[model samples]
Target: MSDRDTIHAHIEAHIGEHIANIQRLVQQPSVSLEKTGLRECAALLVSNMMAAGFTEAETVDVGDDYPGVWGMVDCGKPTTMLIYGHYDVRPVGTEAWTHPPFSGEAIPFDGFPKVVLGRGAAAQKGPLQAWINAVSSILSVEGALPVNLIFLIEGAELLGSPNYGKLFERYRDRLAQVSALYGPKTAQDASGAVSMTLGYKGLIYLEFVASTQSTGLGPQGGAVHSATSVVVDNPVWRLLHAMASLTDDTGRTIAIPELAAMMAQAKPIADWERPLLDAMRAGVAGKDPNGFIPGLAPQFPVKTFKEEVAPADLLQRYMYGPSFNISGLRSGYTGPGTKSFLLPDTATATCDLRVISEVGAQDIIAIIRRHLDSAGFPDITIRVMAAYDWYQTSLESSLIRATLATLDAYDCPRTIWPVQGFGGPWAHFAKLLGIPSLQGGSPGHGARLATSDEFLVVEGDGKVASLATIERYYVDLIYAFAAVTKQ
Candidate 1:
């Protein structure tokens, strides 16, 4: 048999072991939001990388409670690519789940044969472990990897990857050899079609806070009777009004004129985006009705866009639209039953805005602040959590070309997205470090990230890729990317 065929068979031969590795990673809790089990998870990953045959694997302190994990395998190849992933995951609140959030059990799913259900299955843990397993198989089968690898998994990706700057400073010398950054998301539809996203939208994550301390107009000495709210200015009501001013009652469009004007003035389409955008108009629109909406539309089959949204307008709104969304809101009396009488002193609303390249995070923050102040809610403070602008990589880049070639070879239908609504710190950090960035993954479908019952499909139908197939595809991607780098 050919060497490629032999390697693919080897992945299947040890598929059970590969799956066990993923489950082990998934079982470890690394919720970054609560600062829970992060160090233990990092240590567990260090052990996993060492077992997977990395020359060196260890976690480095980045001047925070959370640490960044770094690992490298030197196969004596000239070309070196850096793989970026998050070791930390979103906090799983008291939401009901099909299985325990960290069980990592291969349960029988409705559509797919089996899936590993957990908190970080699709977001980071599942894909990260699969990456390690793929490299291990390549080494076992070929005795060496095609390209050298450097893994830089952050523990604070949900916090906008603030520590990445310190990581770059600490590893400046070692990272000089890296050519590009590969941020792998589990990018497969039920039909097994995957998207090659050229760029990602930027993000400004912040919290809107209103309290007696900040506003000085609310109930002062803690709990007050709801009857007193007639005289006392409720901070929660004031904050809600401020939030409402940012959007209409439906909360679909941005009500801030400055932000909308900024969106209109921004570049309609970038030069590098044209090729993929044109391809998307033809490929994604025809292949799927929802047009590559990722985990939400394809998996759940819901109406994500406006009803009867033409592919062009749907793609435009997705690619360039700016948005303001309240991720979470909290005050008093959201418990099992209502605390009808008590009014709390403080209320907070966690929110985020997606920005295109034309818009800036600073601009968004300033606009929000100005709007809130002008709207007579001067005391409501905008607590900036994390912020970064968007970025795009050319289709002609070696990293992207190699990835597309590999996807073609694997027989997975590819849809090229010019840009998507998802936000990540990959663009800011990759550009800051002067490396091209590419985001992709193998032919596996996963869903429910940042929510309950998050899962990654391990066994697939004829269309979707199984765990073994996903691992083998990663191996082929390494070889394909390596070959293109030589040119």
Candidate 2:
């Protein structure tokens, strides 16, 4: 048998063990938001990396927040590859679940594929462990890796990676030799097709706060009876009016001048993106009459669109569209039946805007401030909660070509998303550090991320099961990338 075949054999033989490792990771609660078990999980990751034949592995202090984990394996090869992933997970709120959020329970149902139900099973821990297992299997059989590998797993991703930029700057010299960044595929559609996204949109999370203290026109000290609202100004009503002015009647279209200009500057979809966009259109068209499209429908429901839009237009809007959303709003009691009617003294609303490459958080905040002031609502303060810019890599880059070749070899259905609608810290490495990064690897389907009943599929080898597909894909990817960067 060839060396590659031997490597695959090793991976297949240890599939059970790999699943066990992933289960172990899933069982540990490493919610960064609550500062729970982060150090323990970081230490556990280091130990696993060392066992997988890394030359050195340890957790590095990013800041006062949770520390970031790092590991290196120098295989005496010229090409160096960096793998990025997060060790942190969202807090498991008091939501009902079929199984405990961190139980790592493997259950099989009649009609659906077998899966491991847990909080972090898919949004990252599963793929992270899969990569570690792939490295272990390759080394156990081949005695050495084909290229130098560097692993950077952070614990602050869910919190917008607040300290990752500092971590990268501190380790810039050591990481300068890294040629490319790649990681496991964390998303899969309802049709069970996996996607390789080349880039992601930027994000600007902000909060609009209105209080009686800031503006004497609103209620003060405490909530007054609803009857007094006639004489007193209601902060809730004032805040709602301010929010309404930001959007037109359609609600999707931004009314702010700066935001409109930024969206107008977005270049038309390029030629290379046509094929993938067409494939996405076909997938959306194939959905049941009442069924929702995988990525687009659930977020932007058909009923919510102001006008009838074609599939391609919808896809383009999702890929390149600048979005403004009200994630949450708060003012008075929202409990069960009812409480004493009163005008809330303070009203606050949380909002998020997904930006393209041309716009930024500061710019958006400034424009919103100007819009509010000019519209006669300057008392509403705009507080930035978090922010990050977006980035895209060239399709012809060596890393992307290698990734495409690897996916083709595995016979995986290839849908190349030119840009993902969500936000991430891709700018740190892709644009700031000037290294090309691509997101592809492992095939697993997950839904309800950060919500109740979150799950990652666990099953045997085949096109249907993700366990074997992920294991085999990583093995092939390592070899394919090594060949692409041969010195």
Candidate 3:
């Protein structure tokens, strides 16, 4: 049998182990946002990584609070690759769920023959375990993988990667040796069509806190009675005016001409990427392009998107568009009744700009700062909460070719988004380590990431890849990447 065929067989033989390990991983709650089960999950990952043939696996201190899990498989190969991931799962709030957040039960649900339901099932824990199982299968079948492997199991990915500074301080030297880094999401749409993405947008989270003392706006000292509002300047109004200038009336397009021009200039889609983007937007293999959009229907009660509020072109806006969002706005007291008689001392508005490539976070912040100042809202203080630049991989890189080759080998209908709208700290890999990075992984259909009733489909209905298929795809990808990238 071929080496890959043998590895696939090994994965099949150990499929039960894979599912159980995935369940076990999920059952351990590692919500970094809440500082729960972090080091414990890191320790669990360390144990699994060691068992999966990693030469080294251990939890490293990430500045403080949340610790990161680091592992490496030294196969004595020149080609080394890092798989970036977050072991941390989003917080499981008080929402009622089909199953307990960490139950991790495998049952038939939502048209899939079998699925594992849990808090990180669709988002990460499931996919992360799949990679480990793939590594284990390859090791069991061939005794060694084709290339060296490294793992960065982050714990604070949700918190804008505040721990990245010290995490890099720890892994800088080892990371410098890696040929490339890849984030393997490999999640399939509900329609069984898979999507490929080459890059992720950056993020800038800023909180505008307007107050009498902090920003020199509104009534001095504490809130004055609303009777004085006719003469006194309201900080809330000032914050609103400053934020309103960010976007046009549609609230989708940037109103700032300079920022808009920067995004447009950065958005010249490469010649090769154009076809991939078109394939995604036009739909692939007879699948509806609209199926790729979640929570989209012909109509929904809770405010469906329209061109006025969102872009008319879904792919164009999703891939290259920058989003200006007001996460939270608070100014006054509306507890039981009228506090409207008095103005609040401070008004705070937390917002985020999902930035694109070629636009640095500092530069974006500078632009926003200048815009607010020039618009005569200098009293509005822009407090940067979190900021990270965008990151992308070159289409011409051997790693990119290897990834595409692996995706194509499955013979599944795949669509490609030249770049994803979400944000991650991938640029650190590129700028700090010189390791170009791409995000995605093997095919598997899953849903409800960071929401209620999350699940990863275990059995495919002849279209989507099952967990076993995903593992096999990773095994194939490792060999393919090693083959192309190695001299």
Q: What are the models' TM-scores? A: 0.86, 0.85, 0.86
**Tens-digit lDDT string for candidate 3 (1-487):** 8888988998998898999999999999998878999989999999999888889999998568889888998989888999888888888866679889899999998888999999988778888889999999988888888999989878988777767657766888888888888777845877666766677788787799777786565667778888888878778877777778888987878888778888776567778877777766555334433544533442323344445332226546666877888878988785776666887778898887887757688898998888888878787788876677887777777777887788789876666566777776777887666667877745898887756888998888788889999988989889999889765
Across 303-368, the per-residue lDDT of candidate 1 in tens digits comes to 554546776656667677776778899987777966788778989999888878555777779988
Better model by lDDT: candidate 1 vs candidate 2: 1
**lDDT against true structure, model 3:** 0.80
lDDT of 2 by residue, 276-328 (tens): 67777776663432243334434334554544676556666777878899988
**lDDT of model 2 at position 189:** 54
Enumerate residue pairs that collide in model 1. none
Off by over 4 Å in 3: 93-95, 216-235, 248-253, 264-266, 284-290, 294-312, 331-345, 431-434
Model 3: pairs clashing at backbone N, Cα or C within 3 Å: 183-440, 184-440, 185-440, 186-441
Q: After the best TM-score superposition of candidate 2, give how far the Cα of residue 203 lies from its true spot, in angstroms.
A: 1.5
